[model samples]
Target chain A: MASVRNLLVFRQLFHKETSTYTYLLACKQTMKAVLIDPVLDCVERDLKLLRELGVQLVYGINTHVHADHITGTGKLKQALPDCKSVLGSKSGGRADIFVDQSERLKFGNLMLECRSTPGHTNGCTTFVLHDRAMAFTGDALLVRGCGRTDFQQGSPSTLYESVHSQILSLPKHYKLYPAHDYKGFSVTTVEEELAHNTRLTKSKEEFIKIMDNLNLPYPKRIDESLPANLICGVTDPVSS
Target chain B: MASVRNLLVFRQLFHKETSTYTYLLACKQTMKAVLIDPVLDCVERDLKLLRELGVQLVYGINTHVHADHITGTGKLKQALPDCKSVLGSKSGGRADIFVDQSERLKFGNLMLECRSTPGHTNGCTTFVLHDRAMAFTGDALLVRGCGRTDFQQGSPSTLYESVHSQILSLPKHYKLYPAHDYKGFSVTTVEEELAHNTRLTKSKEEFIKIMDNLNLPYPKRIDESLPANLICGVTDPVSS
Candidate 1:
C-alpha cells in the first residue's frame, strides 16, 4: 500500500556548465509531472529521466527568461507533444500558457500558486507548492544571495520589495529552491534567508547602493540567451 | 502547531570543485542532526548552516574514504566537540565510531542501517534511513553509472554483487542518493537504477570486462586525499 502522507515525488537535477538547477516534481498517485527551469543542453537527460519515472510530462515551466542557459521547455514540448510550455505573461516570451499573478496551476493532486517576483526580470515568478511548504524561487531569492539587478528589466528597489512581500512573508520554515547556486547549496529556508541574505537583508537604500556598485561584467551569453529564451528556447529555425 | 508526521529536516549540499554531495538530516523535535559525506573545503559553510538551523551536531559520517576529495568529518569533530566521527570499520579509517555491517546508529528519533556494499572500496557502505525509504550510496552505485573500478582496490565483480544484492534489493520506491555526481543528477530510485544503471545492469563477467577496459586516468588528488582521509581529514599537525 502506498502512503498518502508522502505523495509528492521530487528530484533535483543540475546542469554543470551553467550551474542551473532543474526540478522534476510529480504527484505520486497520478504520476503527472512538471519540470521547473529545465536547461536546453539537458533536454535529453530530462526526457530520459521522465520516461524512466513513468510520469506524464504535463508542463515544462520556466521561472523566467533566463540570461544564462536557453530554456528547455520548447525542446521538452517537442519530445512530449502533449506537454505545454508555460511562462509568466510579463516575461515577453512566447509560451503555450502564460500564467498571471496568483494563478493556480494543477497537476495530478498537487497545486502550485504562481507569485510574480520580478526583481530579476519582469517575468520572473516564484512557484509555491503550498501543501509541501516549498517555493521554486527562480532568481528572486537564492540561498544567501539574490539575483543581480543590472539587466533584463532588473531593478534593485523592485526586486527588494518583491522578495520581502512575496517570498519572505511565507512561513519561516518553507523551503526555497533557487534556479542557480554557484556555492552548491540545494535549498534554504525562509527563516535562514531572512537572517542572512547578504544583499536583501540590508535596508532598501543599502541594497540599492550595493546592487548599483556591483559593476559586474556583462553576462557572457546574454545576447544569445535572451533572444533564444524569448522564443521559449526553440532552436530549429523552421518551426520557431 | 508542529506537524508530527514531518519530523525529519533534510538538506542536500553540493561541493562543485569535486562534484561531491553532502547531506544534512535532523530530527525536528530534538534538533539533533547528522551530516553525511561532508567535504573539507565546505566545513565553514556547513558549520554556519548548522548554527543557523539551531541544531546540535551529533554525528559526522563518511560513506567511504574518497579518492576525489578529503572528508570533512575530522574538521567537523574539531568544531563541534560533541560530534563523533563515523566510518565503516572495513574502511580502515580512524574514527570515533567505526560502524559495522547491519549496525544502527541512532541520532534523536532516526536510525541509519549501515550495509557493507564494498566494490568501490573495501570500506564502502550504504546508509539506509529505513523510515524515509532512502539510501546514501557512497560509490558502489551512482545514477545510471557506478564508480570507476580502475584503482583504490576497486573490483567490478564485487561492486556488481554489492549493488545487486545489498542496494538494489531494497524496496523499488526507495530513493538512492550518491556521494558524487558529475552530470548534475542528485537522486534516483532503486527501480530506475535497476532498469537503467549502465554498468551494473550487465552480467558480472561483462561488468568486470567493461570495468577492466575503462582505462581511466589516475585521480589527480588521490595521493593527498588518501593519507589525509585515513586520519579523518584533519590537516593540523598538532592535533591530528
Candidate 2:
C-alpha cells in the first residue's frame, strides 16, 4: 500500500434555483480528484480550481439525480475528455462506471468506499473517504432534518434503513459532509448526527408518520432539472 | 358612527400555488361583508361560503399585488357584480377604489382601516379590522420571519419602517392574520410578531446586514407569479 500524505477538499456554493453545494476531493500525492454532485453552470469554476490546484480530474460522481439543480457530470467529462462519469449501479445506465455498494476505489494512497444509502432517492449513495475519515452523504442526511421523502422514488422505510444500518453503523468519528447547507458549517460527526438529527433519531414508525404528515410538494425546479440530469447535466443548447 | 356590533371573521384558504388566505368580515346583525385578498380560483368558493352563511359581499379589497399567487378580485367581481374591487392607491390603476393610508371602509357596523405598510412590495397595505380587534396584515408580517425584501422592488429599509412604524405600532392585543402560512396556524398577534419574528425584531443596521447576507437567489415562481400579480391576479387566456 502506498503512503497517504495530504488530502484536500474544495466546496463551492451554487445558489441556483435552490442552493446546492458541489465538492472536489483530491489526493495531494497523486493529484487525482473526484467531482461530486456538481451544478452544471459551475463546471468551469471547478475546472479552474482544479488547474490552480494542479489536480487531474479523474471521475465525476453523482450521489443521485438531483430534483432542484441540474448535475454537471456530463458537461465536466465533455470539457475534460479524460474524466469518467460514475454513478451507483441502480443509476439506469447513465454512468460510465456503475459502482456497486461497498465497492472501493483506490487513487494513489487514498481509498473511497461506496455505501449504498438509497433513502433520499432510489439510487442515492454516500462516498466514504477511508483515509480522510469523511463521508459525503448527499441529501440522505441533512444537519437537522432529512431530505423530504415525498417526491420522485423516495421512501421513508428505505431512508430509515440507510441511516441506521449503513451510516450510523460507521465509525463514530467519521465526519459527515452534506451536499447542501445555507449556513457555512459543513462537517459534522456520525455521533452528532445520530444524537441530534431530528429525522434520523426518530423510530422507523415515527419517521414514516412524520414524513407522511409533511406531504411536502415536489421541488419547484423538478420540471427544469430532470431533463438536464437525464443527459448528465447537459443543457439543451436552445434552452441555454 | 354605526352602533358597535358582533364581528364575525371568516377565513378561507385558497390558491395552492401561493397558499393565499382570503378573509370575509361580516357584522352579525347587518350581514354586510368585506373580502380581503381573495384568490382568483376561490371566487366561486368564496361566493358559496358567503351565500351559505347568509352574508352579502359588498367590497373586495387586496392588500397588495401578490408575488406568490394571483388575486381573485377580478373574477370575484365578475361573479358578485355588485361588489367593488378596492386596493391601495399605488396599485397602478388596477383597483376599482384606490384607497390611501388610514382610509376607512365601513360595512354597516364593521369598520376596516387601511394602513399603508409597504416593504414586501411597493404598494403593500395591511387592513385593520377595528371592530374585530384583528388586522389582516397580508404578507407584511409572518410567524417567526418577515417576507423577503429582495424581489419586486423590495427594500430592507422600507421593510424595517413598514414593520416597526406601521404594523408593529398597532395596539399590542391586535391579532394578525397573514395571507399565507404553510403550517396552518392562521393567526398571530402584534405582540407575538414583535417578540417572535426573527426578521422584524432586528435593528435597522442588523436587518440590512441580514438581508444583504441572504444573497438568496430569486424565488422559483417569481416569473410565473409576478405577471399574474401585476394584473391583480387576472391571467390572460393565452398565459393561463
Pick by lDDT: which candidate is best? Answer: 1
Q: Per-residue lDDT tens digits of candidate 2, residues B1-240? A: 433532553443434455466777777677889888887666776676677557788888888877666677777776777888887877564766878898999886778888888877878888887766788887778755677788766788988898888788988867788887643234566776777677778789998888768877767766765676666665455755
Best DockQ goes to which candidate? 1
Cα deviation of B8 in candidate 1 (Å)?
A: 1.7
lDDT of candidate 2 at residue A89, scale 0 to 100 = 77
Badly placed stretches (over 4 Å) of model 2 are A1-5, A9-17, A235-240, B1-240
**lDDT per residue as tens, model 2, A108-213:** 4567899898877888888898666778888887755678788767899999999888778889877777777543234566877777676778899999999889
Model 1 residue runs over 4 Å out of place are: A1-5, A237-240, B1-5
For candidate 1 chain B, which ten residues in a row score worst on lDDT? B1-10
